[model samples]
Target: DQQVKQNSPSLSVQEGRISILNCDYTNSMFDYFLWYKKYPAEGPTFLISISSIKDKNEDGRFTVFLNKSAKHLSLHIVPSQPGDSAVYFCAASDSSGNTGKLIFGQGTTLQVKP
Candidate 1:
């Protein structure tokens, strides 16, 4: 079973528009959540993260909201830019070490039209 799921495999938006990506999880033990953005061949870069104890976290153009009750989380990018066009991955962990061993969803490819 997919512990984490990103229903949409891809999303397309115009530059300067808002881009919202959704994620869902079934495991309650997962206490830490993270979002990573990846390019063609390089490894994913950590964008933002939210702990289960918190409801929301934001960083500049990126905001992540976590709804523990519903086991859902979302990443919102305001004024999405062409440079943001890449694959995004949602990951979860249970207070584990940061060995790059995170349970990741398939990934959502975002295409921004300039």
Candidate 2:
């Protein structure tokens, strides 16, 4: 049973447009949500994160929203640029465990066409 899932394998957007990525989790234990951006052959880079306690969090042009009741989350990137084209991954952690283990969803490849 995969706890985290990104149903969409890929997404395409035009430059300066908005890009939205969605994620869902089956485990209610997940209390923290994180988004990561990755380029081929490079380690994933942390983008933004939100706690289950908050419904929304925003930083710069990136925003993350979490609906605890639905066990769902989404990342929004506004005015997406060509440089923003990359594989995005959503990850969740159960802070109660304190083991520092994260469950990652299958990444969604984002193509920002310029």
Candidate 3:
């Protein structure tokens, strides 16, 4: 069973517009959620994250929102730029004593058109 899922496979946004990505999880043990942006042939780089204690977290033009009750989360990017085009993966981890292994979704490819 997939604990984490990204329903949308891809998203396209015009430059200076807004880009939104959605993710869902079924595991209640996930206490930490993270979003990562990846370029071709490169490892994913952390974008933003939110703890289960917080409903929202923002970093610069990127923001992550979590709904613990719904077991869902989303990432929003404002004023999307060309450089923002990349594959985004939603990851979850639990810090409840065991190993902190990250479970990542397939990924959502975001294209920011100039």
Candidate 4:
């Protein structure tokens, strides 16, 4: 069962613009959500994260929002830069299990044009 899903396979945004990436989950057990950014031939790096207790979290130009009721989440990049272009993945973990295992989305390719 694919618990996490990114409906949009890709998103294109102009540089210095705001980019929004969306994700949805079928499992309500997920309590911790994380976003990862990856480039070609490189491992994914953590971007931003949010917990079930909180609706939003922000760091620098990246922000993540969670809607528990909707079982959805989004990543917002303000003033997106060319460097921000990458394959972004949405990950979620069930803290209740404490197994440290995470479920990931198919990933969305974000292209920031200059």
The global C-alpha lDDT for each of the candidates, from Candidate 1 onward, is 0.95, 0.97, 0.96, 0.97
- Each candidate structure's TM-score, on Cα atoms with residue i matched to residue i, is 0.94, 0.98, 0.97, 0.98
Question: Which whole-number lDDT from 0 to 100 does residue 64 have in model 3?
Answer: 94
* Clash total of candidate 4: 0
Candidate 1 local distance difference test against the native? 0.95
Query: In candidate 2, what are the lDDT values of residues 4-104, reduced to their tens digit?
Result: 99999999999999999999999999999999999999999999999988999999999999999889999999989999999999999999999889999
Which residue ranges in model 3 land beyond 4 Å of their true spot? none
RMSD of 4: 0.5
Clashing pairs in 2: none
- Local accuracy of candidate 4 as per-residue lDDT tens digits, 1-114: 789999999999999999999999999899999999999999999999999999999999999999999999999999899999999999999999989999999999999999
How would you encode candidate 3's per-residue C-alpha lDDT over 74-95 as one tens digit per residue? Answer: 9999989999999999999988
lDDT tens string, model 1, 8-109? 999999999999999999998889999999999899999999999899999999999999999999999998999999999999997755564578999999
Report the Cα lDDT for residue 88, model 2.
99
When summed lDDT is taken over every stretch of 10 residues in candidate 4, the lowest stretch is: 1-10
Distance from true location, Cα of 85 in model 2, Å: 0.4
Q: The CA-based lDDT of model 3 is what?
A: 0.96
